[model samples]
Target: MNSTLWIVRVVLAVVFLASGTAMLTLSRARMIARLGAWIEAVPIGAVRLLGALEVLAAIGLVVPPLVGIAPMLAAAAASGVFLVMVGAIVLHAREREYLQVVMNLALAAMAVFATWGQLAS
Candidate 1:
């Protein structure tokens, strides 16, 4: 169970880090090109805010637990990511991006599992 949670944490951290970094660094045109029309609908500042939150949440998911600080923060961070996934699902669904919605659902489930497992332990 611990091993599985660790794997999930690492995988999710990597994914969110990469995704956040891209959002932070990329120009609107590039983001739109890579992410599709969704980027066009959201304000640039809002997009940047989302990027910052994602990066922070990614760090939160790993650091506190690894360093033996507030380890329970990992569960909180997972819950935060779960909220983000919920938002993603809503936006994707509104846009009729069923594929993205499916991806969000999978990620959201992982987030829930990570949080639940960690808190239970």
Candidate 2:
């Protein structure tokens, strides 16, 4: 179980780090513009803030664990991802993007489980 949790943590850390970096840097304005169409009700600044938070969480997921000082930071970061996934599901649902909602929910579940496993251990 420990090994499995470690693997899950590493995979999720890598994925979120890459994704968050992309969100922060890769055509960020364009990506925010795309999201704007679906969530016109939301402020673009808020979305950008969320992107920044994701990047911070991604760093949190890897740094502390790797450094051996505060493994709980990794779990906390996983929790942040879980929260982001919840927001994603809600946004997708509002946009009637049912498939995306499902996918985000699944990812949220995995994050939650991994977070709990890490924290518990």
Candidate 3:
């Protein structure tokens, strides 16, 4: 079970880090091209802020635990992920992007699991 939690942590960390970096680096036009026109509905600054928060959440998921400092941060990070995913799900649903909503649901489930596991441990 501990191993499973660790795997979840690592996977979430890597995925969010990469995703946030892309969001931070990509221009509005490029993001629209790659991610679809849905991105244009969101302000670029808000996108960047979300990206930054994601990067922090990614770090908070693993680093504190690994360092034996404030391990509770992992739970907090997972909670944050879950919250962000909720927003994403709403946005995707509003846009009628069912596929993206599905993906968001999966991530939210994972985040919830991670949060529970972290708190349990």
Candidate 4:
């Protein structure tokens, strides 16, 4: 169980970090090209805010636990990731992007399991 949790944590950390970096560094046009037309609908500031949150959560998910400092923060970060996935699911559903909805659901499930496992441990 511990091994599984660690693996999930590392994978999710990478996922969030990469995505957050892209959002923070990319131009609006680039983001729209990469993400979809939906990117054009959202304000750039909102996207950046989401990116900032993701990056913070990614760090929270890994750093505290690894450093043996306030490890419970990992669970909290997973919870935040779950919320983000929920929002992603909703947005994808609204856009009729069923594939993305499925992807987000899987990510959300991973977040839930990570949160539960970390908190339980």
Question: Tens digits of per-residue lDDT for model 2 on 1-121?
Answer: 8777777777776766665665566454666454434435556566557768877877776788778988898898889899999888888888888987887887788788878987887
For all candidates in order, the CA lDDT equals: 0.90, 0.75, 0.89, 0.90
lDDT of 1 by residue, 1-121 (tens): 9999999998889988887887899999998887767887799999999999889989989998899999899999999999999999999999999999999999999999989988998
Instruction: Tell me the lDDT of candidate 1.
Output: 0.90
| Tens digit per residue, CA lDDT, model 3, 1-121 | 8898889888888988977887899988887786666788898889999889999999999999899999999999999999999999989898999998998898898899999998888
Question: What RMSD does model 2 have?
Answer: 2.6
For each candidate in turn, the TM-score is 0.96, 0.80, 0.94, 0.96
Model 1: per-residue Cα lDDT at residue 44: 93
lDDT of candidate 1 at residue 61, scale 0 to 100: 90
Give me the overall lDDT of model 3: 0.89
Off by over 4 Å in 1: none
Position 82, candidate 2: lDDT: 96
Name the candidate, 1 or 3, with the larger TM-score value: 1
Q: Mark the regions of model 2 whose C-alpha exceeds 4 Å error after superposition.
A: 26-29, 32-41
lDDT per residue, candidate 4, 1-121, as tens digits? 9999988998889889988888999999888877766676678999999999999989998998899999999999999999999998888788888988998888888899899989999
- Reference-based TM-score, model 4: 0.96
